[model samples]
Each structure stands twice: as C-alpha cells, then as structure tokens.
Target: MGWWKKKKSRAVVKEQTWDRDQWRGEKILEALIQCCDGKPNSIKFFTADQILKATQKHFCKFVFPNYIFMGNGTLDNHRMILLRKMKGRSPHPPRDICTGPPKDVAISSMVSDHKNFMKLVGCCFEFEYPVIVYYGGERQYSPVDLNKIVSWRRRMKIAEEVATALAYLHVAFPRPFVYRNMGLKNILLDKNGVAKLNDLSYCVSIPKGETHVKLTWAGKDYDYMDNDYIFNRVVSEKTDVFGFGVFMQKLLTGEENFEELCGWKNWREKNKFPKWLSSYMGEGRMGEIVDPKMVLEEEERCLMEAFLVLSERCIGLRGEVPKMVEVAKELRRSLKQGE
Candidate 1:
C-alpha cells in the first residue's frame, strides 16, 4: 500500500480508538452495568488528551435527547470508563444529564449514595460501549446462585428488605421520597442476602396534597367513571403507603395482579380487605396468601397475621394511613413476639 494511504488508515483506527475512550464516563457506565449479565473481564483507561479524541464524534449524539449506553457488553471490556462524561459542546457545564421537570425536587436533590455503595475503582470508555471498571466487590462471587435458592427464609428476607426500604422511603427521611417505579429489578441484594433499594431515576418528591383523595382521569374512556376519585390532586405520603400495601400483598400472596386487585373497580365492589386477610390469618392459613416458597413456623403465624391486618388497614382506611414510624413499631412488636 502507498505510504499516504497506510498513514490515513492508521489515523482512522487511532481516531476510532480515541472516540471509544472518550465516551467511557460514569453515567453511561452505570446504565451499562444495569443491563449487563455480569462484570466484564477487564477494561481500558485513558488520559484527558486521549479523551478528547475519543469523545468528539460521539459526544453530540447524547447531548440533549439521544442518550447513549456505555457498557453495553458490545464494547470491549478494556475500554470502559468509571466516571460520567460530558455531553455538552461547551467545555464546562453544570450537571446537564439529569434535565427534567423538577416535580420531585425534594427526592431528586438528595446526595445519592449509589457511588459509595458500589465503590468504583477504575474504568475504561468507548463510544458505542459501556465504560468498564474495577468496582468494590468486583472479584467477589456473583449472586447467580442466590437467584436459584428460592426458599421460605429467602423470600421472607426479600420481603423484609423490601419492606424496610419502602418504610424508609415512606418515613425515615426528613422529607418523603416517592419512587414511582418500584419493581423486583430495582431491588438489589448484597453478599449477605440482605436487600436494598436501587435505581432512583424515576423517584420523585411527593407534592403537597390531601390524604386518600381522588385524582383526575386524563383519558377519554373513563367518561362514566367517577372523575372525583379517578385522578385529581398530587400524590403525598399516603399514596406511597397505598403502594406499599399493594407491594405487601404481592409479597404475601405471590400475586402479580396488584392493579386489578387494588384498582378502584375491585376496591369499590369489595372493600373488605382487612376482613378477608384477617379470616385467612386467623385460620393459620397465611401460607394460602403468602408465597409458597416462604415457610413460617406455626408460632410465627400470628406475626404474619398482624402484618396482613396492617396491610389491609393501609388500603382500607381512607383519611388515616398509619405513619411509617407506627407501622415499623407494629412490625417490630409482631416480629419480636414471633421470634
């Protein structure tokens, strides 16, 4: 090949490599890890000079609307980044990534401890790939085995972790944090089988509003539906209490039909949640409503019953959703007695 042609080809390759390195920042890398099955084998790192070359072409792609996934497994592990990169054309800009309507400013403003919980050691970056890193517990055994061991004990542990996290969200902080999307995927477990909450992206601050009030329906199909209760004012702490009640039912009965069961339609038709759960609990048949994997001792049956009753009251009571402090207190008492 001619010298000029060979030189041009080599330059192109260098640019590609440089571009990949620049995109490997923390925000993109975090997203990549969320979607990855497991950690990569190794990752790349770069100096600031190389970072410019690597990010120039691909940076604009993610600036305002078009978000990019950094550690998508498609990228070679050697080129991942551990820190968040800038998407703006300006050399210096305030944190521009999380641009959205600040409805939940209270929740969003908290200094998230995610970075500390999973302490990042180092990272590599690439344009079309996730920035890789050597994180805390990086060499630890993956929790792949835990997913296989579904027992009563494990399920209860999961339930407690979720409940505690939800309780914290509902009451522990000075201000309430509303997690709009609470799901199994958003729950994380440590090496010790203890669970914690993750993914606060959709979390928002509860707006000022009344308790157990109806909201306005934004859709047209609900013409006949009661407009007073369908949709109206903003959600508050009580709304979270209701969500936790539904979540408790999901954990207990192992049901995935929370919307159908707790919706206005069913709730209106049969407002006997407390009575129904109480009947089941009184019969020592908490298992009937609980996940089959969770096995409770006969002695612990009453504790489970209390929890169920509280959950029922959570939804059944209109103006008086029990405070998280009280709820935790009751749960503590029940668990203590059971133990």
Candidate 2:
C-alpha cells in the first residue's frame, strides 16, 4: 500500500509539471504571434538545459535586484544577464497579455536595434515564466554610487542617453509607449561609460489617435510618479518626463535623504519643487544646490543653471513641459557647451 501511494504521488507531481509547461508554451506562442508578426525566428530561443547550465542552476554569485543574475552564456561564451520572474505571487497580477514577462521579451526584442537600449540576446520558455537573456558587460546604477559619480560631465552624458532612449520609444513605433519606470536603478553603464536604458516591464503604449492612456497605478515608487498620474490615473509621455525629472534631481543633489527632501509631501498639492530647493534655484545659488562631489568651474556655472532649468520644465514647474525629443536636444546642447 505504501509503495502504491508513493507511485501515485509521483505521478500527480509529474502531471502538474506537464500541465504548467503546456500553459507556458501556449502563452509564449500567443505572445510571439501577437508581438512578432507570427515569426518565431525573429528572436532566438534557448533550451532549458542551456539556460540552466549557463546560470549554474541559479547558483551564480552575481545577482542584481529583481532576480537578475550574471553568468556566461554556454552558446556564445559571452557574459550575459539573465532576468527571471519572481517565483511567488506578484504585487500586481497580470490583467492581460500585455503585462508581465512575455511583454518584456517581446518589447526587448523589438527595441534591440537601438544603441541606448539594452540588447536582448534571447529567452528560455521552459519554466513557468520565461527567462530573459541580454549581453552583459554593463553595471546597473544604484543609489549607493551617488558619491562615486564625481564628474558632472559623466552624469550629464548618462542623462542624455536615457532621454534619447525614452524619446525613441515615444516616436519610433506606430504606437507611442510611456516608460512608466524611469529611475537611476534602470540605467546601466557599459564598459565605455555609455548609458543603456533597461527594464520595460512597466512600458505601455497609447492607442492610436490618443494622446494619453488611463491605467491603474502599478508603479512601485510613488515618489517618482507625477501628480497628474497620482490624482487622475493618467499616463502619457509626460509621465516619463516627470519620472526623468525626479531622476535628474537625484543625480544633481546626491542627497542621501532624497525621499525626505523631495518626497510626496513636497509635491502632493502641486507638482513643483519644494520650497527649499526652489529657493536655491530662485536665488541663483547653483553651488549650494548642486552635488558637492561635482566642482563647478566659472564656465560650468551657466551650464548647471541651464540643466536646472531644463529639469524644472521636465517637472512641469515651468509653464509647459517640453517633449522628450526636446529634452534630449537640450541635453545634447548642454554637452556641447561644456566641451
């Protein structure tokens, strides 16, 4: 009886595994059809064995937040970053096929041609959720590295690259996408110090002929979100602009108490800079407000002032925020002026 019971239990487990695999396979196939014009060959597909071997069964020591692991690819022998979906329940459950890992795989493949965007190598669909692979040699930026980034020029370059990527997403496609998540954490620095924008899990496309799309708030960071999104549940290209403004603020201030300084409390009523920060900008005290790590020269003072003004526009403190393309152009002009 004990032997029969054990056999039955093993059979049940096998059946469950097979069922899960089948569901995942169908979902992936549907996504590929919808996103890739029914062309499976558009993006490479790695076998489960290949991915496991590359990642050493998820035992790799180099791990980033959100289950991203660094490993050497078995096929190409090149460093790769493997992004796996979390195992447990998600904070925001998938409401449609447009959400989650499948969308990430599709979008990453579609935007791989852009230099500022992360290059998608392939994906493995053997697991319940697909494992995404990207060519590595890039390091993710973190809040801890604020002081380490001493050069204002380097920070400006990163900001420009990220803005260019966002602009590409906005105009490159027939349907413009809003990059809802735009923080320092999603910016990666390559070996040559080029910034690559990553993590499109929160990306959403506005319907054709529509300027904005309304969506349920799924963002994890409320501080980076704009007042219009928080109060009205609206999402548009302006949403990304607001997020970029917050990101630039962090880069400029390098304040450890970033949240306390420019948190929801500061912008809850109106989407504008806090009184303290506004005062510094109004008084033309660039030295006091800028990052202490960055030493401004006589000529660089004007450049810093221009950057702050641009950031203000992005935050909508000015009359009207400029489009992402305009923002990118402004940053490029600033870079040239510095040179």
Candidate 3:
C-alpha cells in the first residue's frame, strides 16, 4: 500500500512537470506563430524541450526553407538566434550598431569560401540582435550525441575530412581564416558520412602574412589551442593546429578534458612520444590505445600510425607545426595509403 501511494505521488509530480513543460512549449509555439505573421509557411515547430533533447539547447527549431532558426522567443528582447543562411547574403545578420560585427559574418565568410561549411541562412533584424535562420541539414543525422560510438576508422575519416575543410579555410580563402571555436561538438557528420564544421562565431580572418592575431576573448575551444593562445592571448593558424591536435587526442585517448592532455604537450615540448604509441606503431599493440569500440584491424594500423604522427605535428610549436595545407596533404596521404 505504501509503494502504491509513492508511485501515485510520483505519477502526479511527473504529470505536473509535463504540464509545465507543455505550457512552456505552447508559449514558444505562440512566438513562432507571431514571427511567421500568423502563417509560418512550410515551417516545422519543435518544442523547446524537444529541441533540447535533440540539440541540447534551449532553442526550438524554426526550420524553414534553407534555414534552421534556433532561438528562445520571437521578440526583440529575446535571446540571440544563430542563423546559417545561404550564400552571397549581406555580411552578418542584422544587429544594433553597438554590438560590434554580427557573428553570422564568420559563418558567411566560411560557406562563401567552401561548401564543406554549414551555410548561414540569414537573420531577421526585427529584434535587437536579429533572429537568424541557418541552412538545413539532417538534424536526426547529427553524429555528436549518438548512443553507440562507431569505429575509430569512421571517426578518423570524419576528422580527416574536417582537416581538409579547415585547410581550405586557412589556405584557399583570399584572406586566411582562423577558426576559433573548434571542437567535436561543432563537427557534425551527416547521414552521408561527410563532415560539416559549424559554429563560426569566433572565427576571424586575418591578413595573409600575419603570424598571429590578438584576441579580445578566448573561447572554451581554446582548450584545443596551444599554450601560446591560452596563456599569452595570441591566436594564429598554429592555435588552430593545437586545437586539431586536441581533437585527435580525444579520439585516441578518450580524454574529454584538455587538462588531461599533459602527454601530448609534454611530447611536443620534450619530443618524448608516448611509449604506448610507439609500441602500437612497432609492436602491433593497437588494441591497447585505440577505442574499444573500434577493432583497429591489421590492415588499418598503418593509417592509424600515420594519423597519430600527423596529429602530433599539429600540436607542435609554430616552427614545427605544418601549415593547414600541409596537414591536409598528410591526411590525404594517410587516406590514400590506407586505401
């Protein structure tokens, strides 16, 4: 009888919580309707909670043609909406004159350079900061938060493709771009297994010959950067290289936090590569370090070894670090060799 009472009480509490969430969802739905001028055409309205479950954000997806508008409300005082509109749009989504350059500019500049990027769909400036719409992708196909981790080969492929895309940004662009906010969370692997790098808010374009650019505020992705950017506040292509190295480490070691990365940094500073890595390279101990989820088959070992070496150089000091173009070349070589 006591258990029955407890279960009943718990049921009541859950019902109440759902009711509250439903009410909140209704409010956002109302805002969406208002934003659409009472006729939100060909648009899909996702509840904030549903969007949270999907994107881990408070934003509800106002998905429309060539854009996904993720934001809290439909008012001028609402939270900023991240818009990823399509090509040749104005620089940055509309914003007040005082908020500095609109962040969409980074994304615009990115997709403008290459399709490997997620396109900026554009933003509406009725609000103070502008409600943005980004180009659409398979939201369900986002590989960041999957339940079953795939093979390392698959993941390494994703990393390789992203490295090539980054190279295009840093090298192919008339003015080199420094992608600041780089992390696994922002790299989306679609259903087709192609990699798409998103979140260009911190990306900056600097002059061709400049070694480093001064930063006003560093991003959490700074964990991916070298000590120079994290400690000295100097950003450069090397900073991006360091970040990419950290990303590779994430795949190799499963060390989620940057603080646990002393091995890579120590190797960079002292040239003391990990014994386990050496063993894997020479003694075929790939299983010891490779993700348990991955088999790291004999045929694939050479590719992994080359990738590991490339990742290490990506973390090296400025003089030792290869250009993004060079990094892309090495990754392509690894892929071709493995093939």
Q: Using Cα atoms with residue i matched to residue i, what is each candidate's TM-score against the true structure?
A: 0.51, 0.82, 0.62
Which candidate ranks first by TM-score, i.e. highest? 2
Q: lDDT of each structure?
A: 0.42, 0.70, 0.54
- Residue by residue across 14-51, what tens digits does model 1's lDDT show? 47656434432433344334322243422234343344
State residue 80's C-alpha deviation in candidate 3, in Å: 21
Candidate 2 lDDT tens digits, 1-339? 111123445456446557555655565566556655554445677766676567665545444554554544444456656454434324243663346666666778778889998778877655545567776644542322566778888888988998999999898877787888787767777667778787776677887899988876645577677878877778899999988887877777775545555554666556665543455776656666777777666787787778877888898888899999999999999999899
Candidate 2 clashes: the total is 0
Estimate the TM-score for candidate 1: 0.51
lDDT of 1: 0.42
The local lDDT score (0 to 100) that residue 149 gets in candidate 2 is 79
Candidate 3, residue 51: Cα displacement in angstroms equals 16
User: How many backbone clashes does every candidate have?
Assistant: 33, 0, 12
In the range 1-339, model 3's lDDT, one tens digit per residue, is 111123445356445446443443343344334222354323233332332333343435644333344444232223233443332323332221111224333234336436566544343332212233444433323535323455666667777777887787687646566776677767765557778776554566665577767765564444476777766777788878778876776676565322233464555567664322433444756555665555556777667666777777787732488888888777777777776
Best by lDDT: 2
